[model samples]
Target: MLVYDVATRTVAAANKAAMRLYGYSREEFAGLPITELRPPEDRAPFLEDFDVLVSRDGPASGTRGVRRHIRKDGTRFSVEPTYHMMRYAGRRGCFVVVIDVTEKEHSRELLSRQADVDSLTSLPNRKRFNERLEQAIDDARRNNTGVALVFMDVDHFKDVNDSLGHGVGDRLLQEIASRLSSCVGPSDTVARYGGDEFVMVVLENGANSDSVAGGACQCDRQSEVIAHVMRVFAAPIAIDDTEFHVETSIGVACFPADGDDAETLLRRADLAMFRAKSNGRNGLQRFTPALGKQADERLSLSRRMRVALSNGEFRLEYQPQVDLQTHRVTGVEALLRWHDAEHGSVSPATFIPIAEENGLIAPIGEWVVQQACFQAQAWQESLPGLRMSVNLSPRQLARGDIVCVIQRALARAQLAPQLLEVEITEGALLNAGSAELLEALRAMNVDIAIDDFGTGYSSLSRLRRFRAERLKLDMSFVRGIGVHREDEVIARAILSLGHALGFSVVAEGVETDLQLAFLRRHGCDVVQGYRFARPMPAVDAYTFIHRFNAGSLVPS
Candidate 1:
């Protein structure tokens, strides 16, 4: 090992091991300066520490322990740089020993990088995004600059998962990540924020920083980025020889404009993205106060709906369906009504679709069935021949559990299957072939009528396949029976087709005398309209049926 001389400031001598440790010839070690072992920038600090060591002890004492150093090749490795407070070449000096730690330091650096990088996309993850955002925020505050944070989400991404499968969904996400990376500059960053959402941060530059001192200016840039992103995402991305199209809706919230912090800005951007999807897909939106309020309202309404069934906030109204020939109350169709505690009497049109989408329709449907059957049993006890018809939504049909629900309701109500009619629209039956629940319902010998028959797409062949007992013509076909030739022809044809198939035909929404006369002429088995009775509660329906049977009814 070489000994370092403090008084003379020279390398006195070197052993073979010391010369090899520093990748130097013995002569080279003797000629080289001690400062050569340290980085140029660290040499000043090293020298200051050296002066303190020399004052406390001789150079040999300072070099007694290990010291870190770099080689002449500019490669760094830690060294003991040990020294002994003894005479070297008749001068007080120190002996140095070196040990290499290059591999260990390199490994630590690699692990640090791996922690920040995403394994799949190879882009940064949300963790790295947060850390980078903190630095960016500090920089923005110091330089008085602007930063934009964009939140982008894929539109109809669930469809990809549903139709193509999750494998394709994963591939699509990867391709999208690549395309997004291409759109942004090197100074900006794009991160996969989780799920199908991504976050991008772009800092303001040059003169733009002064004009837009807040991060929200990037909200305007959302349209530009979205246009490029959409064009890139719009074209099909292929997976396993199949090409799939993808689109996105972006929400933009600028730093300082939306919020200076990460959480607030991210939340706002998420809200704006949801707004874009709600307004219509394939678009971008900036966060707004009104949109936030609307989201809060919808969330409140959805929460209330979830508890509605449990709280017994629902009611059923029955509208009579009369037989024209017998002039008797053949059946009453059950309609659902909701009386919201906050927003009273919500319309079926408004909440029904929401219920279906949220998967709440199945339970709500069961309640309707049980209530309708119980009411029909009550009416049958009073009138002896009345039937109750309950409408089935498409969502309920898709689940294929309607038969089991009906069986349970009938058992609870102690009602005969014939007196309980389930009305399913044509749309519900369109995909009923593979539905075991529907097939089970057909096997039960319960009356299944195709309600609003002509309102949906149906074929003569498909109509024959359904286990239906009656066909109720939609109001549209019955609206202008005598006035419009097409309407008359369609109504008559539907009635004829129903009769030919051994099914009873009923004309719904028959409000006029002419429409009733026209249907009676066309051999319609039944007619239901405001002319007979509007949908009313059970008490009124009982009175209306009694009055009609007594021939004491007045024309409205």
Candidate 2:
């Protein structure tokens, strides 16, 4: 307990409790003002203004601000401070009562962190990011300068979450956020914003409106901030000392010229981001009027896609994955196709993302799995022990229902689980949930293969964790087999690495003898594409396999 004179601004009397809490003896504390108990930075403010606003109080209410007291050893702790007018034995003064609430302070700190920071990446959360953006815009407008907002999110994030364990997936998000912060200037703001989504703001004060507008020259600042960031993100994000492919679609918008307010600018920038991902992910697009129209068109397409799902307009196609060594058909991957009554033939590349976006991917994917299993069973008599490879969408995998669907499909077709291989992208194998699902599939004797292995950003750590049975080399690398040494190196590396890891390598898109010889020499176990035969109907595929087995049909 301490009695402080408001008139003289001095501590008049103190007890042993006060001395012990403060590490100050009676002589040391005598004649000192109450402000002396505060840290150096807060002392001046307490004397100049805080005293006027905070002192002369009853029980400390929410209206009274929280303050801290510093010990002689320089340790500061939060205290609940309240004072009331009282007369002491000798003089009249304020009787101050302080209750140290360090534990409550710790709880407050945790709550504050949870509100402002992303739990997974420890970066600024969406609310904090928005606050920073709003502040930047205000400052930019006052100074007649520009503030650029960069909206970015990971590409194929669903694949990572669905394939890898959630723990690794979270670690991947942290890795990306850490890399982004490294490239970001101290004055700029970088935030996680949300799952796999990030937002950044860079302030350029004293800029003219022309420079603030989204144009070719907006990227010409002396610091070249955007270019530097792009260069940094170009490298694959490394996690646990292994590479996980990282790519993002970035959208940029400027203040004043692009949009005066936060909502307007964010909306425009987000539209541009959608354009980048739709055109091709892993790129940047600045806000423009045209892109907004395209965005509207996409929204229309998404609505149409929801309708298409109800009408049962989706179909499946099978592409055979052939064994190179034995010259036998190992499996066929089910592919989705859709023909819109109004738009004619719509490519999977176009409608597939829309389906995923509109929440139709799960049901559509379940249908494909069931249909493909039925067809595989129908052809099993002619092609005994033939396998069926079905592609699992990221959404289906994220929901972790693909395994149950696979079990039901096998039951419906009376197909052996060994003859059912589910093809998944390397991106899908990075999260804990995916690992659990894959482990379940493995336990059921279902074959698991990582589809398009080399093309996507991959992690070696995940490969050994997957218990995968096959590695399907991407067509992009296979097409360049004889033409590019770099492609040859990558292909050979994949085959060698895969074989070393005990995974069968299925080289895709083998259209020429040169490609075939290259794959065979490199020890690829399987080849699939036009070089052997195109994806055929179930009946033709069975007959083709029978003839090939009888030595009547041969590779061209």
Candidate 3:
């Protein structure tokens, strides 16, 4: 502790602890000015505060607070300073005591920095970003300014990590952080929103705000933000003597128009970012009302999908797969359909993705397996060699319990595993652990068929890794096959490839005689489309089977 005389502005005395801490002896502190103990930047503020406190509170009243003080070695540390007006040496002076609070202050600062900054890139983290967004919104509200939230994500960042290494990825993120900071103004806040995601909150005057009705940034300055980000990342980055080009998808949402709050703006911006990537990478998108409508519907669908099974909204229709050589029905693929009384018939393309995302696919897939197996036994008895093929969601095979589900269904229905072919999309096979799961299914004697082949950018070598028994060609390649040379070439190539792999090929969307003749000429084993038959109810299917077996079936 050190005692100083306020009237003479001199240190009166010092204790042993003060001498050791300040690297000064009691005699050395005998005539030192209080300003000498504080750093230059803090000296003026401390003196002003002390003068104000003494003048307002009178003589014996004390003032206490924390401040930085320089030691004799010129190193600065924080201290809890207190000044009491007291009588000393027969004159009015201040009794000053400063308690070292450096350690406590350092610990608090460390925790605060750790919470706000990303450990890898040293950029602001999501928590700090949220707080900054709230403050920005508050400022915008007061000043009639609008805030712009920009969401950014590195395109194919996973491929970069896989090809190079995590070390390179980390360096790339650091470089990205530097570039992001360079692109923004001092008033703007940049944050690491997620693993490969970065966000920016820009404060701008509403004089040039976006037009909410158009869902666009009509203001040139607002649109310039996207252009600036593109220009910053246009060049290739050199990492470890290697040059690599990276592209980013950016999305923008303006405040007081896109949303009134932070979370809504963030969500809208995220949706716009998805739209940017969907339109092709290395681009930008602004939040539109259509995106919000779709997002709302998706949320509703995701929530409702959980109870759709119990409500009996889900049903199956079977499309016949006719053997081209024999002109006989070899199998039928089970197609899922959903119809709600209030929302009406929802398209499979729309709701299937919702089901897969919400995890409703697993239970729904199990239900389909059981239903198909139960229907397959009776139909097999009627047609003698009919196979049951059910389409499985990509998530269905990801779950480890799939094989057990297949076993239980087959056992309960007494259906032969050979007659049950599980159809999976190439997208599902791209997921990790799917190959092992499919192999496990095959080990149990169930057949595996690749569904919607030629759609996903799947490698032929990777395709060979999975022991698939059949390839159901996607409908896109089959459409206008005889009309368009491009479709004809693609369809022919897929058919030839399937045969070369010793896998049976099925031509889908065969709606006309020309398509049927085209597949027949190509020696395609199966033809599945409208010309054969639309997916019919079980009772109608039984009736159709009776007619087909009797050699009197005609296209309806």
Candidate 4:
């Protein structure tokens, strides 16, 4: 407890609690004015507030509440000090009651920080980051300060977790957080946005009032800040007593330039980050309106894909697979076509990756398998030896119960495993690894082929390890044959390797007589491309085979 002589600006009396709260003896407290307890920065504010409290001629009841006070040791503490209008020692003054809420305030602050922090990194989480970003944007708008939101993702993070244990991965993440913290200003915020991604909100204009007045200054300065922040990963990160080199791809979104709202800015920044990854990692990309437009297009395509698949707008077109020696149709490749209600024909390259990312491929893949199996079985009854091959994406290989699905489809269509072939890319086999799924498919006697080979890493290794029944050279390599000198040698080597490994070789994208003749000369077992025939409807395929058999249509 304490008493203040407002007119004289001196302490009237001090109690034990007041003395302890101020970290001073009663004699020392009595010698100093109550305002002395406030730090220099708060002293003037306290005096102004005290003058307002005294203008009423005495302390108002209940109107007085918590006021900040500084200790003799130059530490600040909050105190709920109430004053009463009373005549103390026959002088016009006020009676004061001081109760320290410093501990309570400290506890509340700790809880607030804990709520906004990530448990793993002890740094602010996305929730807190969002709050700060909104406030920063508001401030930037008002003062014309430069603000940048940087979205960054670690490169090869999956490999880190796969090659090293997750424990080491976690440690690496922590180390990255530390390095990121060291790269920002005191007022800036760096938050772990999810998994290996991080969001950094930087305020570049603090005292530069001119920068605030000029709306363009904020963006210009922010661009430079973003460039520096992105280069933070040029150095290697040492983790677990071993040095490992890694890079970060960053995307920058600026206020009043890219977007006005936090959500839009973050989304644009994320999309730009993906663009950075696509253009080869270890660089920073600024958000462009064109990238946003592409993102919108992708979203539109994805939504339409769901409708296309559900509305039965998809169909299988078969391209005849010819034998090199006999020139007879041995199989037909089942290619997917989409007649989108809104966008017309959507290419597989456009929707396939989107479907895979959104988990829509499993169902789409199953539908393809079932439909192709049914069609192949129908054709087999006529041709008696025609096989149908359908392509499977990596997502389908990773998630689908391929063995069970194929068995059920075969039983439903009454088609044998030998009559249907499943084509998967080298990427799929690399991810599929030496799993039980591959072995189970083999046990069922399903002929598996690696499609679009030589395009992805581990093609030769995967072909050998999976014992692929067939290998289809990608159109890129096949198109290069006879034009590029090296392509011919590589093509010949691939064919020899396939034959030596007891697998049949198929050349794809054969669009000319020269390519076809060259492929046949190289002992290629089969060829399928536009040169033979574009993928056609089931009825057209049957009619074409009939015409060829009748000698009306000659084999090119």
Candidate 5:
């Protein structure tokens, strides 16, 4: 609390509390100028405002909002001052009270910053990035320049998070954010767009807007920025004393060429990034018209697939697997087929990947399991030993409920577990939770086959650890058995290795007489392909199996 003379603008009196706050003695504070309480930069404005307040005819007794005040030690803090017009010892004076609000203001500022930042990496979040991108686009339009958006995704990031724990994954993301930040300029903005994905907006002044040879805008500045970003991942990232060679797929979309608005630019950049990943990852791509068309087609197909599943447009075809020595159908593999009302006979090769990407595989896979189990139960009346082999996708295994899904399917159909076989690719084994899922299936007496062997990076240690019942030679190797010597040698080695490890070898895509002879000579336990019979519907498969087993249908 203090009192100041209106005429002289000097402090007339101060209470003990005011002396303690200002770090001054009573004698020193008594005649101090009122402006001295404010910092030097604020003192001039304080006097002008004070003069107007004193000249007013009415009493001025209200809060003056918030202002900065310097203590005797020269430390500045925020305070709210309230003053009243009054008389002190027969002299015109003002009585004032100050309330410190430094801590409250600080808390508000911190909350504002936290809303714009990513909690893990301390980079700007997507919301802040979008806001800045809109502003950049506006500025570029005025300056006749370009703004390039770079969308990046960490390749195989889920493998890192699954194999290593999420703790290591978090640390790895932090390191990636730091490396990305080091590659951009002051004018550029880098942000964490969400999980394993980062985005950047680079201002390209005087960039060439003309189309290049490949239909891409020739933006030299953006090219340089992308090159710098690529080099950051050239070296291995070391985390917790372990080195990992991380890879990223980047897509570039420039303003006024790929898109004019922020939303359009972001979508196009995302489409281009997927193209980079499809071109085998660890690369970069620019947005083009053809890429946009492809994305639209993919989106249309994905929507159709969801509706197809609900409307029963999907069905299963079984390809018979024959025993080598007896030439009899031993088991059948269930293959999914889709026949759309508008576009008939869509190939599995085209739609399966889309299913996996859009997360439709989980529901589709469950339906396949239930149908296959019921079919196998129906076939048991004629062929008791026939096994129903169904492919299990890596996505399903990662969901952590695949074993229970299979168990429920088998129990509902009253099918014996021994008659069911779950076929998984070698690539699926590399995922986390797969081994445990396979072990759980094995515990229930269900057979496990490593499908498409030699098509992935399979180590002897993984083979020895998983201990699958069967190893299916991929069709690529089987197709080259008679023509390519390298393929023949690989096929022979795989057969020898499979037998040595007590795994029954099943040769896929065996279409020729020479290929069949080669596999029979090498002791391949089973074979399935066009040589026997093409994939048939359930009714056709049941009749074909009866005819083949009764020695009526002969192999061509």
Candidate 6:
């Protein structure tokens, strides 16, 4: 406790506690300026505050809140001081009470850190990232500079979690966080947004003479940072005894160009990240106005697709697969078609990706399986040995209940398991739990076909890891047959590899005699394309199947 003359701003008396707190005896503290208790830098502010308090009409008797104070030995600590008007030795003065709050302030700081940082990676969590991003944007505006928000997603990270386990996944994330931290400058902020996504904020200031012109320096700096980040992942990350070749898709959004606010910048950066992934993973994409439009359209389509299946707007069309040698209809690939009341016909290429992204693929996929199985069963008597091929999405397999879904669909339709061929792309095989799912399907006597053979991350090692009965030559290669020598060579190599592995190769998109003849000459087991027929409704497909087998639908 102490008393200081309010008008003179000088200490008049002090209690034992006050003397000990400031490392001063009562004699030494007496008549000293009250501002002496505060640090030198704070002394001027203290006097200004004192003037304000004394200038008020009423008595200044309230808390002064928390502040830093210096002791006689030059040591500093935090204190909360409260004062009240009083009379000391018959002079106008104020009695002050001081409480040390250094530990309290330290504890509060620790709590704040815990809330702002990710426990797994020790990087700033989304909350802190947002705050920092906003500050960066404000700074950029004031300094006539630019800021870049870089959004990144680990490519096929889910597969690692599913195949290796979550422990490995966590370790991988930690290592990624470390590498990302090492690549960025001290001024930049790196954060783990959530899951496999990470984000960084880079400030572009006039530090470089070239940056004085415009945003070009900002773009250059962002590119340099991104290049560093990419180089860090070039080598395989070793965790435990296993090595993983990790890849990331990056998206960059710039201030004053992509967006002005934190929220807009972050959202646009995420959109650009998706664009990078879609344009084939392990690349970078910059934000553009067109990407925003595409994102809005995707969201709208996703909303409409949610009620599509329930409203009976979805149906399956059968495209016949012809045996190359026999020229007989051996099976049909079930393709989903949507004829929206408002949008007319929506292409699968357009809506399927949106469905996958929004998680509507699960229910829609189940419906496709059920309807296709039912149709196959209905044609059992007419096309006795016909196989029903259905496309299974990677997202469906990721759900971990794909085998159960297919089992239930087959049971409901009473279709033979061997007669059902589930066609999946090479990309699907890269997912976690996919191998187990395929094994379970094989155990159930279902045939597995690797669709889109020459296009994905397919290797002999992966192909040998799982058992599949057929390989569908992707139309991209088939389209280039005779037109591109390279495509033809790849198509033949795929055919040879499939045959050598004891799998029948089915060529898709055989729209012309040249393509068909090339497949037959190359010993393709089956062929399906527009040359025979485009996809048709179940009723029309049934008639077409009969006509096809009767040789009446054969092209002259």
Candidate number achieving the greatest TM-score relative to the actual structure: 5
Q: Whole-model lDDT, candidate 6?
A: 0.90
Best by lDDT: 5
Per-residue lDDT of 130-234 in model 6, one digit per residue for the tens?
A: 999999999999988899999999999988888889999999999999999887666779999999999999887735433322333554778877878878899
TM-score of each: 0.67, 0.60, 0.90, 0.81, 0.91, 0.82
Please list all clashing residue pairs in model 5, or write none if there are none.
none
Per-model tally of clashing residue pairs: 6, 12, 0, 2, 0, 0
Model 1 scores worst on lDDT over the 10 consecutive residues at: 207-216
Better of 1 and 3 by lDDT: 3
- What are the C-alpha RMSDs, in order, of all predicted structures? 6.7, 8.7, 4.0, 4.7, 3.8, 4.4
Per-residue lDDT over 1-556 for candidate 4, one digit per residue giving the tens place of the 0 to 100 score: 7788877788878888777777888778774876787777877888898787777843475545666888889888888877676788888777877788889988988898888998778779999999999999999899876578899999889888898889989988888888787666667788998899999887767533333223335435556455455566667788758786768888988787889989998999999999999899978898999998999999998888888778888888888888888878788899988878788888888888889877788888889899999998887767887888988777777774777888989999999988888887777765735346777788888888888877777655556778878989888888897799888888888888889988999899899999998899989998988887889998999887767555688756
Candidate 5 local lDDT, 1-556, one digit each (tens): 9899998999899989888888878998978999989999999999998988899997788888999988889988888889999999998899999888889888978899989999999999999999999999999999888899999999999988888889999999999999888777666789999999999988786332331212234357778667777788888899988898989999989998999999999999999999999999999999999999888877888999999999988899999999988878999999999998766788998888899999999999999999999999999998888999999988888899999999999999999999999999899998867888899999999999999999998788899889899999999999998899999999999999999998999999999999999999989999999999899999999999999999998876
Tens digits of per-residue lDDT for model 1, 250-276? 888777766788787778888898778
Ranking by TM-score: 5, 3, 6, 4, 1, 2
Q: What lDDT is obtained when candidate 5 is compared to the true structure?
A: 0.91
lDDT tens readout by residue for model 3, 126-164: 999999999999988998878989999999898778878
- TM-score of candidate 2 on Cα atoms, chains taken together: 0.60
Q: What lDDT score goes with residue 91 in model 2?
A: 65
Candidate 1, lDDT over the whole model: 0.78
lDDT of 3 at 458: 72
Q: Global lDDT of each model?
A: 0.78, 0.80, 0.84, 0.81, 0.91, 0.90
